[model samples]
Target: MTTQYGTWRKSRLSEANGACVEVARSLRGTIGLRDSKAADSGPILELTRREWTMFLRSIRAADKIG
Candidate 1:
C-alpha cells in the first residue's frame, strides 16, 4: 500500500553535517521515516504506531543501560 506523509520532523540530536533521519506520521497512525539529506529521492520506512513506540522504547532502554 502507498502512504503519503504530510510533515516531517528531524531529531534535535541531528548534527549539522547532514546525517540524520526525518520522521512523519500519517493520518492512519502509521509512522514514516526517511533520510533527511535525501528527502526527495530516498526510500521511506513505514511502521505502525505500536512498532514505532516499541522501537523508541528499546532505544531509550539501551541508552539507560549503556
Candidate 2:
C-alpha cells in the first residue's frame, strides 16, 4: 500500500548513544519502520496489522521468558 508518513514518531528505544528505529503510521493497515540513523534509506519494513500484532506478541512472550 502506497501510504504517506506524516505522523511518524521516533522510537523511545533511541539511545543517547544512538541506535534506534523510527516508526510511522501509514495509510491502510500497514506499519512503517525506518532506521533512525538513515531514514533517507527508506522504510526497512512494512507490516500488516495482523503481522504487527503477532510480532508484538512474540516480543512480549520473549520478554516474559527472559
Candidate 3:
C-alpha cells in the first residue's frame, strides 16, 4: 500500500554535518525515518507509533541512567 507521509523534520540538535535523520508521520499513524542528506533518494525505515514511542522512551531512559 502507498503511504502518504507528512513533512520530514530534522532534530533541532542536528549538526551542520551530514549525519542527521529526518522523521515524518504517515496518515496510517506510522513513522518514517530517513537520512537527512539523502532525503527521498534514501531508504526509509518505517515503524508503528507504539514502536516509535518505545524507542524514544528507551533513548530517554538511557539518557537518564547514563
Off by over 4 Å in 3: none
Between prediction 2 and prediction 3, which has the larger lDDT? 3
Clashes per candidate (backbone, < 3 Å): 0, 0, 0
User: Which pairs clash in model 1?
Assistant: none
RMSD per candidate (Å) reads: 1.2, 1.9, 1.3
The order by descending TM-score is 1, 3, 2
| Model 3 residue 20 lDDT score | 91
Kindly list the per-residue Cα lDDT of model 2 for residues 1-66, writing each as its tens digit.
466766778877688876877877776758888877887765468888888899889988999999
> Tens digit of lDDT per residue, candidate 1, span 15-61?
89989989999878899999998899889999998999998999999
- Candidate 1 error regions (>4 Å): none
Q: What is the lDDT of residue 51 in candidate 3?
A: 92
Candidate 1 vs candidate 3, lDDT winner: 1
- Per-candidate TM vs. native? 0.88, 0.79, 0.85
Clash list (residue pairs), candidate 3: none
Per-residue lDDT of candidate 3, residues 5-51 (tens digit): 99999987787877898999999899998899899688889999899
Task: Return the top candidate by lDDT.
Answer: 1
